[model samples]
Target: DVRTTFKRMAMNDEETVALTAGGHTVGKCHGNGDASILGPKPEEADVEEQGFGWKNTQGKGHSEDTVSSGLEGAWSSKPDRWNHTYFHLLLNHEWESVKSPAGAWQWEPINMKEEDKPLDAHIPGVRRNPIMTDADMALKMDPEYRKISERFHNDPEYFGEVFARAWFKLTHRDLGPKSRYLGPDVPKEDLIWQDPLPTVDYTLSEVEIEDLKKKLLNSGLSQTELINTAWDSARTFRGSDYRGGANGARIRLAPQKDWVGNEPERLQKVLAKLEEIQQGLDKKVSIADLIVLGGSAAIEKAAENAGVKIKVPFSPGRGDATDEMTDAESFNDLEPIHDGFRNWVKKDYVVKPEELLLDRTQLMGLTAPEMTVLMGGMRVLGTNHGGAKHGVFTDKVGALTNDFFVNLTDMSYDWKPASDSHYNIVERKTGETKWTATRVDLVFGSNSILRSYAEVYAQDDNKEKFVKDFVKAWVKVMDADRFDVKK
Candidate 1:
C-alpha cells in the first residue's frame, strides 16, 4: 500500500515527507496494524540499541507471525497537538528502530524520559502519545526525505505551512479537478465579474454604518463569522450547491440567521440589529450587500480609528433569499470544519479540520489567492483558525489590519510553542504575548505561492494595499455563490 499511498494521493516527494513527519503528532500504534517483532520501550532500552526486526517465533499466535513491528517509542515529546516536534525528534535526536510487542517495526526515542518528552495530545484517544511508524521512518530512510525533515525541524513556520497544504492533500482527496467548474464552461473571468460590480442604492450613511459597526463590534461576534454564515446561506439556496448566489438569492434570507458558526445567537444578534437598521432605511439595497458592505466599512472605520489606511470596496447586488429555501439539512451540510480563528482544528472537533478546509473551500469556488487573503485578514480580525480572543487578537481585538500577516512573516513577534503546534507571539518589551499561529496561519507565511502576498503585505507602506487585497478575497467568498450559472 505504501507504493500507492503517496502516488494515489498525488503527493509530490516534498509533501510526502512533510506529511509523514507531521502526521505522527499524536496517537500510538497499539500493535493492531501488524504484530511481528517485539521490543521494549525506548526508555528501557540502551540509547544506541536497535531492536529485533525479524526474530523467529517458534509458535506465536500465527505460524508466520514475527512478534514485532518496530513501533514502540513515542515519536514526539508533545503528543497532544500538531507541531513540528515530530520533525524535531526525527532530526534533532537519535531514534533506533525497535520492534513492538505486536511485531511492528517502529522507531523509539533513544534518550527521552516520559516526564521530559515533547508531546502532542490533541489526537482522538484519551492520551495518545506520538510514535514513529515504519512509514514515518521512511523520511529518514531516504536521504532526500531526511533533508526536508531537517528543514522543517529547523523552520517551524515553514513546517506548519507545508503540513497544512499536505494534510489537506492527504485527507480530503486525490489528484482531481482543481476547481469544480473549469474554465470555458464556467470561465474564470465569469466567476470573477468586477468590471461592473453592483453599487449600493440605499447605502448606510457613514453614521448608520458606524452605529451598526459599534453594535457588531460590541456584540462579541466576529464579522468574519457573520459573513461566512451569510455566504453559506447564499450558496445553499438552489441545492445543486452552485446556483442562488450570482443574483444574491440568500443574502437577505432569515434562514441563514443561525448556522454552526453563529453559535449562541451571534448571527441572531447581528440579524436582530440588521432588522432594526433595515426598518428605517429604504428598500433599495439588500441585507446581504449591507452585511458585506457594512463589514468592510466597519473595518475601514476600525482601521481609521487605529490610524491605519484602507481602501474598502463596495459590492451591492447581494439580495436576500426570499423564501425559506435552506433547511436543517442544509445547515448541517454547510457547517464549517476548518475554523479560521485558531488556524487549526477546533478542540471540540470530532474530525480532522484540514480534511474539510480544502474540500469546503474548493466547493465554494475560492482560489488560493482568495483563501490566503481571507485567512490572513481573519487572523488580524481575531478570526483565523480556531477560537476567538485566544489573546493573539487580545491587543487589536477588532482592527482589520494586516498586522497578523505582517507580524508572522516579518518575525516581529518571536513565536514559541504554547503546546506542540500552537505558539504565542511574545512581545519583546514586557514579555507579554497574545498572537498565536496555527498550522494554517503558517500556510500564509511559508507557502511559496501564498508567501508572496504575505511578503507584500508585510511592508509598512502597503497598508491600504493589504486592506484592498483582503477585501478582494473577502468579496470573492461573499460573492462566490451569487451567480446563477449552469452547474
Candidate 2:
C-alpha cells in the first residue's frame, strides 16, 4: 500500500520552506540544470512531419536565425502574425493563381462586333451598362412617387383633375373663365316695366282695403316679436340654420348647487358614489401596516392618538438618551441606517415607504424594539469587519496550517464579537507514520442570520406566536452569543 501522511507546522515569519516526501519521482530529474529543458528548432524538423506549413506558420519566423532559436522566440519576433497583413497577401496570391473551369482565357464582347467574342455563351441579353434609362433612374430615386402613380392610375377623374392642375400651373393659365384677370362682370337689367298700364276705373270698397291694411300690420308685428325673443326661435325652427350661430348663442343650464353651494349636486353625487365604492374596497383589501407619514404633522399626531408606534431618528430633549430624537449626523449614520432602510424598501417594495414598512413588519416581524437591536448590531458588526483580514484554510485535507492561521493572532485583537458569550475548540488527529493535522473553525452572531430566521418564522402559518417566539430567541442570542471581543 502507498501510505501517505500530512502535518502542519507553526513557525515565525522568517521560516519559509515547504517539505513533502514518499511519492515516487515519476519523470527525468533535472535537479537545478536548465540545458535539457530547451525547446525545439524549426528547419531541422520536417515541415510536413511537424505539421508546420505556410498556412499554419503561426510560430514560424521570417529570418532563419529567429526560427532556429526555437518556436517561442521565432513566434515572438514574427511580422506575419500582425492582423490582416498575412491574410490579405495570401488571399491576393491565391486569387491570382486560381483558374476558371473553362480552362482558357476569353475576352468578353465589347458591343456586337464580329472580331470580339460573341455575347457570353452562357447568358444572352445580359448586357453590362454604366447608365440606366431616365424612368428606371427616377423610379430608383423616388420610390414613393411610383407608389402614388400606381395607386391613382385606376381613378381617371382624380388623375384628370391632378393632370389639369399640373398643366395649368406649368402653362400659367386658368380654365375656369376667359375674362382678363378672371373677375366677375355684372349684367344690366332691361327697363321693360317703365310704362304703367291704364287704370281699371272701378274703385274698391273702403272697409275691404281698410281691413287688408290691418291684417298686413298684424303679420309684421308677429314677425318682429319672434325675432326679438332671447331664445332664437326662428333659428331653432329653421333646419338650414341648425348649427349656424347656435354655439355662441347657446345657453346650457348648470346643475343646481349642493347645501354649501360650492360643488354642484350632480358632481357631489358622483364623488359620493366613488367614495362609497372605495370604502367597500377598503373592507376587502388591507391598507399597509406601519404607515410613515413623512412631513405630515397632522397625520403623525393622528397616528399617535391612534396608539401606533412611530420611529424618529433622534431629538435633543425628550427625557431618556434612547427617547431623545436626534438628526442624522453623517453618511455613516444615514447610510447603513436610513439609507439601508430606504434601499430595503426600494428593492423589496419599490420605494413605497408604507409598503416597505409593511413588508418589514410582515416578512421579518420587525417590531420597534427588534428593529432597533438588529440595526444597532449591524452597525457594530460593520464597523468591526470593515477592515479586518479574513482567515485562510488548507486545500486537500481541509486542515489549517499555522502559516494560514497566523492571521488569527491579530484577528482576536481586531474582531469585535457582536455578543458576549462564545467558545472555540482546536483538534489534532494522528495520521500515517509521523504525521498529524489540525483544524479550526469559528461561529458568531450576525443580524443577517437573525433576520433570515425571523423571516422564515414570519412566513409560517402560525406566524403571530412563531414570530414572538423567534424574536425572543433572537434577542437572547444577540445579547449572549459571543466570540473574541476585540479592543
Per-model TM-score versus the true fold: 0.47, 0.12
Error of 1 at 196 (Å): 24
Across residues 1-487, which tens digit of lDDT does each residue of candidate 2 receive? 0011111111111110001000000111111112223234455546654744322232232321122212110000112222111111211121112111222221111232232111221235432211112222222234543343333333434544544433332232212112112335321321111111112223224453333223322332221121112111001111211111111111111111121111234333333332343355422211100000011112122223323333222111101111011111110111111122211211222343333333433323345445433322222122111111122222211111122222222223233332222222222232212111111112111235443533343242532333234234232222110111111
Report the CA-based lDDT of candidate 2 relative to the real structure.
0.22
Worst 10 residues of 2 by lDDT: 16-25
Candidate 2 deviant stretches above 4 angstroms: 1-338, 344-369, 372-452, 455-459, 465-487
The candidate that wins on lDDT is 1
TM-score of 1: 0.47
The number of the candidate with the highest TM-score is 1
Clashes per model (N, Cα, C within 3 A): 61, 5
Error of 2 at 338 (Å): 4.1
lDDT (tens digit, per residue) of candidate 1 on 344-363: 44354544444455555566
Clashing pairs in 2: 314-325, 314-326, 315-325, 315-326, 421-482
Give residue 483's error in model 2 in angstroms: 37
